[model samples]
Target: MKKLISMIAVAALLITGCAKELKVTTAENLKVEYGEELDNTKLFNAKESDENVKVDKVEGFDAKKMGEQEITVTFTDDNKDKEEKLKITVEDTKKPVIELKKESVGITAGDKLELKDNIKSVKDPVDGDLKYSDKTVEKDGYYIDKGKLDTKKAGTYEVKVIAADKNGNKTEKSFKVNVKKKETAKKPNGTGNSNTSNNGGSSSSNPSNTGNSGSNTGSSSGGSNNSSNSNGGLSNNGGGQKPVNPAPHQHSITVTGYPDVVYSNMWFEDDTEAMYWASNYEGPNGDWAGFGYSSDQCSCGMWSPYFFNVTTWE
Candidate 1:
């Protein structure tokens, strides 16, 4: 009876040593972004200690949408079934928020415009600032419609600024722009400063040229000095002809996008005189002195407001 008992104990030991082993090690809760594909191997650390062990099947998971899902991993060891389960969370259901602050602005006909200036901020609950750039104007994105103003013609127009977030959330606003007609200068009459050496229109020492009726002449002293002054004045006169761009006039001129720049309240002689765009010179304070401008609208740097409330003499 002692020998038989020893043999049985030895057999039990052998049986225990031959038993198959299987294990599944993974976190209880896993997280993933919305719409991301799910992989089984990456989902869990599963393995069988015995060479004959195999994965039988896996079930109880649907990651198609945003929600919590349960995954069951099943395996077989020597024809014996074993199972384990884990929880997966599909998050990212929050949408981005955008606010349009400066929804509208009025600019001159020839001025450049930026639609994004309308946006106060672009924010998201999950991902902060979106760093939105011009690329946001592409398809499934946003854009500005510079409608009807003709940009070259003076009149009232409706400009539409639109935007969209990464999750397809969208918003838009409209601005009414009033482009007033450009001001033009007129020819002076022979009544006032046209008199030669005297206040009246008569002088032989320096005969007044009646080429154009109201020519102004505060004849600068000294011949060469006079010539230089005359040349400068002529160049600015829109065409070598004296201009009577006198003013107690008010203009609501605004400059945007370019900073530390300069622009002028020019007095064009005619519509065709628009060629004098290069004549933009800085004015003194209380005028257009420290305004901003960019020769090319497409590449203009920063954005800021430059309001011109001009009051000019002759």
Candidate 2:
């Protein structure tokens, strides 16, 4: 009777051991992906006891902290207490961003123009103060429609932008910079500066000019472009090389050979004779002894039409 009783107790203990060794499955499948984040603590497993009893919470088992779901399940008489560790990794697959900015305006050729911009598009893939260049006339992205246009020259300038993403994915956008000749500067009074100068044929405000009787043509105003400099800025005033044109050595008359037009612009007969060809200069009074040009449109020694040059008079 004593031996039978002892055997019954041992059988009960063995059954309990087998129940605790049952393997448990996680409530949800372990998942890993790029650009995704998960809680390290709540990831857990689901299972049943040997009697098929469902488990709610294990007394001291934790599923979150190991940076992934990791747990060891021990097997009993039914198995060799096998244990395994599971991992849920998050992958990195996001790319970076890029951008550009500048002012807006129309452009023309034969007219000096300037292009300028500050590259400031931001993104995680690249460093700050990002650098980019382009030729598109549009406002943003890789293309810049604005730039310094050399009005004297005509053609299309290709605008391109090259940049890299966080994963080193290279991107480039291109646009066209067209340059063509525009209309000449209009004369004053909406008539254009071609036919008249300041004071309307009376004032030679611009010294180099004489009298423009034929018609005032070919002059510019308000047409400008940014200058090409270290900082990339707009350039309105012209800053370049001169054509090496020299001043005339002697003065010659071109009024169909006015014989009285002397080399010194004097009649030479006398101060009174000087008055004869006085009309050759400018002013309605026909004064010649003035030594200085009266006709605001003072032609060059080579007979080249004198435009408007304020520096020539003084």
Candidate 3:
């Protein structure tokens, strides 16, 4: 029985005087191929013996040579009479590696994200299925897909990406996202007010023409100090009569009019008709005496006529 059989010398064809006989004995019929190895045992289709057992030239491929490689196989008969060989090649049919590009991102609400980096451009050692996330946000030349990230809400969020090839190779990565909050603007004066028209209807412009709010007291400027009212005081468009006085309405007047401010002594609105009272004091009966709006400049002085009647008594 010859154990180590290889391509060897062939006997010459015997020839007679008139004719010649060629002896071409066919070697055992065998097949061979190489493929990626799996973690578990694998079975290759080869001719089997009558006992249903594999009787090929090779037993099995070594797991270590799982990558692209070449395998040699031979087949022989039970009598160990002759043998033949076949060469097979194994290769990886999986795409290259994929990973996250950017590690972190900071953005405000209503902002969109672009996961361009992590998207796999392409890797080597491939042949079979090479596909990216179908659910990704595709753009001009980028594939953007995230596991868990919503920018609408205000808070920190995390985004992750995963990729796998047909060969069962997998890769995953993540990112940090910071979202900003929205803000609203506020009015300067800190108050909202409008006045009525002559016919007591809503008017775009309030004819009342107030000097502002706080403690203010002053006589009429250019306009007639006294109008045709029951009381010789400035009159509302309604013909209502109210006396205008020059008494300071508030203790302190933060006048935006003058470059400088008039922080009067607290006693300004306190003494006699004075409306100033450092501590909270309504009045001998009701609220304060003459305090209402900021002091408006008048020929007489700074005073708010609209506050209380300038004439008559308290």
The best candidate in terms of lDDT: 1
- Candidate that scores best on TM-score: 1
Q: How close to the true structure is residue 305 of candidate 2, measured as C-alpha lDDT?
A: 19
| Better candidate number, 1 or 2, judged by TM-score | 1
TM-score of each: 0.33, 0.29, 0.31
Error of 1 at 123 (Å): 16
What's the distance in Å from true for residue 79, model 3?
Answer: 24
Off by over 4 Å in 2: 1-12, 20-35, 39-93, 102-120, 125-153, 175-314
User: Per-residue lDDT tens digits of candidate 3, residues 1-314?
Assistant: 24323222122222323342221132232222223343211223333322222334543455334343333443233333223233333443443454443345555557775655435453324433345554642211112345456676555566655555434455446655655543348667732334333323344544454433122234346564433343222257565555567876442333454343323233322121122121123334554443322233333343321232212225
Each prediction's whole-model lDDT (CA): 0.52, 0.38, 0.38
For each of the candidates, give the backbone clash count. Answer: 3, 42, 21
- The list of candidate 3 runs beyond 4 A from truth reads 1-96, 117-130, 136-145, 186-314
**Residue 301 CA error for candidate 3 (Å)?**
47
lDDT of residue 154 for candidate 3: 56
Instruction: List RMSD in Å for every model shown.
Output: 15.9, 27.8, 25.8
- Cα deviation of 63 in candidate 3 (Å)? 14
Candidates 1 and 3: which is better by TM-score? 1
